[model samples]
Target: MITTRDATKNDIDTLFDLILGIAKFHNQEEYVLTNKEEMLNSGFNNEPKFGAIIADFNSKVAGYLSYTWNYSIWNGCEYMNLDDLFVWEEFRGQKVGLMLMEHAKNICKEKNISLIRWEVEKDNVKAIEFYNRLGAKITEKGIFRWHLNASN
Candidate 1:
């Protein structure tokens, strides 16, 4: 059976491993620079920058959903931005991802947040389908980013 709950400081190492698993799945492990210490500091600090929900299967860490709150100027309201949602390869197809998403939705509902946003790689057809099944729509806007310290 799978259960979901908010992540705590004790789960940082497992969270780091899952994060690397996500990077590996995306073939971008070489670009992952953050370490467990950094994750712990950023996630468990006095003022956390993000929040996470963990999916546990038989007392083992099986998956996680990390997110942050963002303000939409156009909407003039706060929304939840899902940063990452990942389930271990061994646990896929068991509705773990759906459970995580539902957990996120519950959090938003409790906080009176009406919108949730996330981005998935274009080629990840399975993930895209999953999101579509959850009633998410693909927007036409393209994401752009500028690296500030590429030399580092």
Candidate 2:
């Protein structure tokens, strides 16, 4: 049986492991060890800008969905941005991802959030199809990200 719940401080180490697993699965292993402490602090500290919903199978955490809230000036409402949704390889086909999504939807419903948005790699056809199946539409608009640093 699979159960889902919001993550707490006690789950940090497990969450860290799951994040590394996802990075490895995505072939972005370099990111696996990046900012480990800060990331954990951000997600599990007293004031968190992000939140996570984790899936537990039997007694082990098998997946997680991490997200943050964004404000859309045009819509003038809070939009939930799903940063990452990952299920362990052994648990992939078990509807864990969908369960996390539904949980996020319920959160938005209660918070009066208007929309949920996420970006997927253009080459990830599998994910595109999955989102489409969930009635999520692809917009003609593109997202541009800029990192403000001393070099810039």
Candidate 3:
């Protein structure tokens, strides 16, 4: 069985591990800049920057889902940005990812969030199919980014 709970200060190490896992899975490990301290402060602080849920299977860590609240002028209420949803390889095909998504949906329902947004790597075909099965629309809008630094 899979169970989930809100990530706490004590889970920072595991959370960071999961983050690294996802990055490595995507072959983007170089972009994982934050560490456990940053994760703790960002998610467990008085004014949190993000929220995360940890998934466990049979008392072992299985996965995690992280999100942030964002506002849109187009929509009057707040929405959630699903930053990451990763299931450990050993736990894949066992519905851990589905449970994590269900948990996120319930959280949004409680918060009155009508939308949840996330970007997947273009080459992640399996994830694309999963999102499609969940009825998420794929928009043609392109995502752009800039890696900025103070020294730049």
**Residue range 1-152, candidate 2, lDDT tens digits:** 88899988777777788788888878998866545577777877778878989998887787999899999999988899998888987887788888889999999999988699998878878778888988999876677888688999
Model 2 regions more than 4 Å off: 32-36
Report the lDDT tens digits of candidate 1 across residue range 26-107.
9999988988888888889899989999998888788999999999999999999999999999999999999999999999
> What is the per-residue lDDT of model 3 for residues 27-73, given as tens digits with 9 covering 90 to 100?
89999989888777778989999999999999999999999999988
The better-scoring model by TM-score among 2 and 3 is 3
Question: What's the best-to-worst order under lDDT?
Answer: 1, 3, 2
* Candidate scoring better on lDDT of 1 and 2: 1
Error of 1 at 97 (Å): 0.4
Deviation from native of the Cα of residue 61 in model 1, angstroms? 1.7
User: Over all chains combined, what TM-score does candidate 3 have?
Assistant: 0.95
State the C-alpha lDDT per candidate.
Answer: 0.93, 0.85, 0.91
